[model samples]
Target: MKPFSGTSLTDHALTTGEVLLTYWKVKAEYQWDAGLAMSTYLNGLKQGKLLGIHCPQCRRTLIPPRVFCELCFRPLDQWVELANIGKINTYSVSYVNWDATRRQTPEVPAVIEIDGASPGMGILHLMGEVGDTLEAITRRLKVGTPVQAVWKPDSEREGAITDIRYFRPIG
Candidate 1:
């Protein structure tokens, strides 16, 4: 038995606040490349295809695609094609513009959980064609409302997030 010098424990307790502050500073810098999955999935987008990853263990398809099986903690090389349509899980009206530079006239942003995806997984994009009378819209926002990405014109295409202008109602 030696002296109980818990340096690791002391260090964690002493620097907890500093650790949290450092995380806050780095959060914006940590950009996840969900878009890169497009290499595998976006071919579908270009040809109007919807792609997802299937986990054999959970037997669930994960949209936006993943390289590893999250449920089984294994690697997934299998790809599955999904429907181009999905549902809006939730949405909000944004009054602020990007970079907070100005007040956005009025826009609806939504979290769409596509069909055939794993539980608790979704994508965020702009919601278009929202009517003036908000009450007329269904507030339920159930798990199966059909939606699709509205792409920008070739002249305006920038090969980035903005390429898909917005996720709008599939009417």
Candidate 2:
């Protein structure tokens, strides 16, 4: 609707429609590969299971599912079941959903260093029963405190990211 001026022809376009037409010329491309390993991991979540790969070389277990070890730069061939239990390393509460479509209805997000994982290792997830005081860093939630996963109903279960509904405090 307005004329924009700049060095490039696209930037110098006289109309919004023309500018959008020129923008596609420099669009970036990406390729995604969904293989069996990833599918298996998702399926496991739906079944209320937590999985990880163990690096025999370093004796460290990686969670949140990875096919390789970045520390040793080696392919992790051995797989293991990670305890669904973990600890709240760090956490936060979001007033809005990530897509930005939902209004501010408090959601608690946390980074749990799953049990059995090497020290300082953790997975990012949400915490259950957390409210607007998500910024309460001085409270409990110590790094080694126990936690567990909260799963979705079987009927609504999908072998994907929504599998484990969320994580919660464990006694």
- For all predicted structures, in order, the TM-scores are 0.62, 0.70
Off by over 4 Å in 1: 1-38, 132-144, 153-161
- Model 2 regions more than 4 Å off: 1-31, 96-103, 133-142
Q: Among these predicted structures, which one has the highest lDDT?
A: 2
State the C-alpha lDDT per candidate. 0.67, 0.73
Count of backbone collisions in candidate 2: 0
Each prediction's number of clashing residue pairs: 1, 0
Tens digit of lDDT per residue, candidate 1, span 1-171?
988865344576657764433334454566566454667675555555567888888887887787886668987767877665578887876666778865535577788887667666677787666553445344523346678877776666544555677776774
- lDDT value, candidate 1, whole model: 0.67
Residues 1-171, candidate 2: write the lDDT tens digits: 898876666545756556554344757898776565676677777777777778888898877657778888887667677788888888765666667765555677778888777876787787775444645532645656688888888777788766777887778
**What TM value does model 2 have?**
0.70
**In candidate 1, which residue pairs clash?**
44-49
Q: What is the lDDT of residue 152 in candidate 2?
A: 85
